[model samples]
Target chain A: MGFLFEQDNFALFRDGFLQTIELSALSALLALLLGTLLAAFRVSPVPVLRAFGTAWVTLFRNTPLTLLFFAVTFGLPPLGVHFSHLVFAVLALGGYTASFVCEVIRSGINTVPLGQAEAARSLGMTFGQTLTLVVLPQAARTVLAPMSSVFIALPRNSAIAGAFSVGELYSAQQTFSERGYSIFAIFFWVACAYLLISATVATFFRFLESRLAVVR
Target chain B: MSILNRPASAGVLYDAPGPKARARYRLFGVLSVLGILGLLWYVFAALDANGQFDPDLWDPFQYNFVQQMILDGLLATLKAFGLAAAFSLTLGALLAAGQLSDHKPVRWACTGIVQFFRAMPLLILIVALYYAFFAKQSMWALVIGLTLYNGAVQAEIIRSGVNAVPRGQGEAAYAIGMRKTQVMASILVPQAVRSMLPSMIGQLVVTLKDTSLGLIITYQELLFVGKKIASQPMNAAGFPYIPVVLVIGPIYIAMCLLLTALARWIEARGRRGANRRTSPAA
Candidate 1:
């Protein structure tokens, strides 16, 4: 257990922790952007966009994230499409999570009063304008809490990147646990680190919600 | 994604396209279709060049031995899922009850356990359990690991469901001189079970899929079996990567869809008021 905090081991944990954070942040950001686009497409009048968005969600969301990683890591690289294992992992995570974010955002969009869009329409706002200016802001406000769950989930899911040999916390735990220390101790400490990350994301979003909350 | 039954209010963002807008939409549709086609073509061509489409690579599944292995693997996978789902649900129900307990220590203890398990990653939980706790018996490790992590998730679902029960219902139970346990068992849990049935089933779906994480520790589940099949030297196609994915992928999608279909059936039963008898307190 003491070996966990030894100078060399400590650096491994530090790097792994930072990498986990980076992976989560990058994946969450990408998922948010992709999800928002899919949400917009879902509500669009264009039949094609709506179909594509539906296909994206159905195909990716139902498949396990592990399989997605398997496909990206194994399937693509053999076809002469090479990327860093981390990059493929990020794509896999973002791709799967975006489907969830799309659902959460769509539910939020559905919550916005229909009359608000009607009112925006009467004021000469185009469909795009109504969505971007009136609906999205309201949807964004409503989805912060749900979206926070998605982001919190992102870091935890980042652990799967270890399957691809990505040097994240899970991989670090694997390494340390292999070094003859108690595996439970290694997991306990890494889980504590993850708990801190989850709590921070949850707490920060809570603060943001309070600050941005609007009275009806 | 779009196959979801659209709620009646789904199209709130915009109206139907008018004549000119319809023409523009059709053009956009054509371009999008072409883009998708081109991407698919690129993948097809590249994979062909890489020999991923060799029929010889896929022919191994025709053998009894290969087929039996996959069948056994699927059963093993289901067994893990079944155990995890049962234990996790039981654990979740108990933890939820404790979190809602009248005693502060019990409530706090349950809450702490739930949060700790929820915060931990499933991979680490499974791996740690495999290596540290039950190194000799990998099945117990996987099952218990899944139970702890997913039990935490199910605890939230159960807790929220119980909390969502109407306050007046509990009050009425108490007015009838019902004890805390009785009120919870009869009044709150009954209603909560029906209302939260969908989410509970959703969690089960996740649990079933997550059993594949056993692959990380050589648990010989479906995904791991698929990996075993995929990695075999029976084919000269340099690892039948695409062929393996093509076969194994649909099996998973089918199972997940089956879970979803079951959820829908249960939901519809509730909607039809067919299960009202289950909630005797109501």
Candidate 2:
């Protein structure tokens, strides 16, 4: 525990914590954007686009995050693609998480009453207009809780990036362990950091949920 | 669910297209197909330029020793998954029981354990356990870590399943002079198991995927073996990283898909059996 207060060790820990936060934040944004696109594709009238979306979801959802990490880290360079470790980590985590986010959004869209879309259509609105203006707004409320879970999972999944040389909290755990610090103390602080992230995300979602909440 | 099988709610998003709309859709479809094909071709060209499609890079997988190593790794992955699945299910059951206990302290303690473990990143837990206790036994470290995290998840599922059982069912048991333990064992659990089976199996798929994490600690599971194979450079084709991913990635995907299919199958059967029981009674 005393080692936690040491200037150098504390710096390492803070950097790792910040790295984890950056990874989670960047990937969360990517996931939301890509996932929303995938969800739209899934529900659109275009068969090819729908097929493409389904394939993306199935492939990402079924594959292990570690395998995805390895593919990004080792496999992509062979194919003439290159990026920094952090970028690769973000791409992999965001791509993988997008599948889950797509599912949650699609389910949320399902919860929107059929009459809402029907009313929009009867008023001469186009499919795009009905979806963007009518369906998605209603879906957003229901999507909040599940979306939070997905975002909360982002930080946890970011831990895997540490192994792929992304310098996150889990990597910090390894460094601390190697430096001969008490394993329990190191894990304790690390766990607290993760808990704090989870709690913060959960609270943010709860706040959003309340603001958008509609009385049945 | 497969995307081809559209859900009932899908019809809400759009009505049947009129002639003009249908023509527009056809045009859009063709453009999208062309776009996808162009993307695929680009990827193929890139891989080809790098000699990733060379037969030499894939040749290592043909050897008997290499095949045996993959088999051993797969078996080890399954072994870890089996142990973790069994232990986690048992732990989940106990914790669920504890959470539902009439004793307030027991319930609070169980809730704390579940919540803490649930929030903990599993990789962190596994690594911590490896360093703190199972330093030499990486397999146990992975197994225990998976057990703790998944057990908490399963406990919530089980508790929810039990609670979802109708109040009248449990009350009837109590009204019939059944003891608390007897009511739970004979009434709540039997019903809850039916509802819990799908999610439990889903968690098992998660556990199987997580066995790959054993590679981080040098557990020599399938992914670890794949990594080992990939790291060794073959003649002129550089490391066989792409080949390894192509081969090993599908195995993980197939296993998870199979588990998911099994869960759906079991759930369907349970629902059918349930209908039969109710219809006969009616």
Candidate 3:
């Protein structure tokens, strides 16, 4: 609490906290797209696609995010692929989170009636066309809340960026600690920053959820 | 106009994987998979080429040091996870009861703890614990952090499970003069336990994986062992980092999958038990 009044460490907070938001927003977008596609494949009639999707989700979801981040930073270099720490952080966070999002979307997809797909096909729509025009829209509507939760979850998950030495919010906090900043103040502030971002994202999602629910 | 011409064949929905779409999907799938394999090959090849993968490069795995480190790390990981899991579940039950309690402060406090902890990242908690409490050799840091965060999650899960049980049963229990604790422990929890068994196992899976965070605090867990081994693999193999990752990754995967399969089995047995009890009702 006393550290809140200390103006020196405020610079770290401004930069590091903003980076966290940026990283989270990017990863959330990437994860949503990747997850939606994977969930689609998981439920697709193609057995191979379904198997591929399941394996991907299970592998990523089950592994600790720290190890995954480590794998990205340390594992890829030998293969002649080098990502900046920021890129590694986003890719690992996005890729890992996409797995969880896939499960959420799949659950939403399951809730959708079989008759809708059947009805769309009866209208002579291609599988892709029907999925895009009919199934996805409704599924998206149903998943609004869960997806919003996932979005809120992004900052928490982004904590792994700390491991990459990516200088994100948590990492910056660590630097301040090393510099002899009060541990309690730094952590308490980190917790508050997390709470603020989470509440904002959650409230925004609730608004979107109600909006979609009304349309339904 | 677009809504009227839909095909009427139910078979088309399941059966008709168009030839072009099927072929294209397969081609893309095969190519992507092959690309992954090729990537792996390139990794190993480069490591081999650099003489970094030498079999005799460094002797970190010499009789005592590496093995002892791994054993100690594994023990710490297990200890932390065990304590955290037990504490979290107990805390979760208490929190759940409070959330369901008639008292507003109790409910609000429980909810606040759950929300606040759930919102804070587990890694942040671990680091905070490190700085705040255990500055040195802090297994307690890891354990407490994991417990605080995971306990909140478990509380929510248990509460949801209990809520899923119809309301009439609770009212009936109250009518019979059963105490609140007795009602919760006897009727509500057992039923909720059966319903939430899968989720509990899922959280356990999460707890197991999170043990790797012990690495940040230098807690010498499995990944820590792998890292040490990779940097200094004995014999002629150069730094076997990727091999270490391959080894560790699958072990983690195997453990989680085994837990998942076990959860599935328990859920099946639970279903049978549920059916047997409810048979008369049915």
lDDT of 1 by residue, A18-95 (tens): 999988888888998999999888877666677889889878878888888888888898788898988998899999
lDDT of 2 by residue, B160-180 (tens): 999998898999999999999
Residue A121 C-alpha lDDT in model 3: 84
Q: 1 or 2, which is superior by TM-score?
A: 2
Which numbered prediction scores highest in DockQ against the true structure?
Answer: 2
Give the worst 10-residue stretch by lDDT in candidate 3 chain B. Answer: B1-10
Candidate 2 chain B weakest ten by summed lDDT: B273-282
Q: What TM-score does chain B get in every candidate?
A: 0.92, 0.95, 0.80
Q: After superposition, how far is residue B199 of candidate 2 from its true place, in Å?
A: 1.6
Instruction: Please report the TM-score between candidate 2 and the true structure.
Output: 0.97
For candidate 1, the docking band is: medium
Error of 1 at B87 (Å): 0.5
| C-alpha-based local distance difference test score of model 2 | 0.93
Which of 2 and 3 is the better model by TM-score?
Answer: 2
Steric clash count of candidate 2: 0
DockQ sort, best first: 2, 1, 3
lDDT of 3 by residue, A1-216 (tens): 777557667888878889999899889888989998998777665545666777799899888887798788887776667868888889999999999899998787766778888888888887677777887788887888778877887899898787778878888888888888788888888988999999999988888877778443
Model 3, B1-282: lDDT tens digits are 121132233233443667977897678668766776787698668876766555454345455976677677667667877898899999888888889998999999999999899999889999988988887866788888888988999999999999987787788998999998888888788877888989988898898888888878777688877777777634555456666676678877877788888999988888784354463562
C-alpha RMSD in Å of predicted model 2 compared with the true structure: 2.0
**What DockQ results for candidate 1?**
0.63
